[model samples]
Target: MNTTYRKVIDRITAQTLALTEKNREKLSACLERFEWAKNDLLLREGQVCKYIWFVDQGMIRLFYNKRGKDLTEHFAYEGGIFLSLESFFRQIPSRLIIEALEPTVVYGLGYEKLHGLMETEPEIEHFYCKILENCLILSQQKADACRFETAGERYHRLLQEHPEVVKRAPLIHIASHLGMSPETLSRVRAGLL
Candidate 1:
């Protein structure tokens, strides 16, 4: 592999390791690197998601269409993981759309290959468990934000969590993710001033 490719995979292994060099070699060998540009579709609805991606650089968004409108569900940035977890794990068609929000470099492992690695490498399994735990925690936070927070509060939380998105993404995109209209988001911003 090229040096650039090795560096990116090394970064992913670092994150996957959770600061521990447990099974970096096993995980590293199975990884593949790919680059994508802003607005490019990484995974589409109805496609069987093949790989679980690790974002080495830039950002990605996961969304699904609702009444012909794209509803943003999740955002993964540098040092974050990106995958259609349900589809990849179940080996079913994906219901969500995954796209790069900026020019991105990613390291991915095919679902089957990842499963094989986990089974063969106990330390890899530990890293996988940690990644899943992060996923679950974030899912729970999103659910709680939707249920209990006001629209403005939820928007605030999103900004707090991903401040770069406010500058990088279009206002409409942020509005949709927050389940609010652009006008409402403007008003909310004004109210804070």
Candidate 2:
């Protein structure tokens, strides 16, 4: 396995579940790597997501179009994992689209293969559970932020926590993700919001 890929797996496992070398090797076997160019579409609307993609470098975004406007839902950069959760679990087409925001390299673990391993490998099962728990927590935090924080507060929190996203994502997308208009984001960026 590539060191970058292995390191990502290790990072995800950090303090959550420890894997034996043999188990780690088995996990690594499930990861296949691919490089995507800037602006490449990793997952399209109506495509069932089959892999959990872990970025080794660069950035990706999950978004959907509504009334012909793009609504950014999430962004993940290096060392981050992303998937269309419902689509991956339910084997249904996703309403969201995923795209590479920069020249990107990712390792994808097939949903079916991983689930199969989970059935037999207790550690893998535990690891999968940990991942889901983390994802749920993060999802709730985002929902809470949207429900309770002002746009400026939300933007500032994002800047403080994931500056990479603010620095790299398009202003329009950032604004959309924060549930505000681009002009609003501009004012917030200027400290006027």
Best by TM-score: 2
Worst 10 residues of 2 by lDDT: 7-16
Query: Which runs of model 2 end up more than 4 angstroms from their true locations?
Result: 1-4
Candidate 2 per-residue C-alpha lDDT over 10-89 given as tens digits, one digit per residue, 9 for 90 to 100? 87666357888877878888888889999999999999999988888999999999999999989999878888888988
Show where candidate 1 strays beyond 4 Å.
Answer: 1-10, 13-22
| Candidate models: Cα lDDT each | 0.80, 0.88
lDDT of 1 by residue, 1-193 (tens): 3555556657765655542343555566678888998889999999998987888888899999999999888888877887787898788999999999899988887888878877867777777777777777887888788789888898788778889888787788788888788888898888752
lDDT of 2 at 160: 97
Q: Which 10 consecutive residues of model 1 have the lowest summed lDDT?
A: 16-25
**For all candidates, what are the clash counts?**
0, 0
- Return the lDDT, model 1, position 103: 96
List TM-score per model, in order: 0.89, 0.95
Q: Model 2's lDDT to the true fold?
A: 0.88
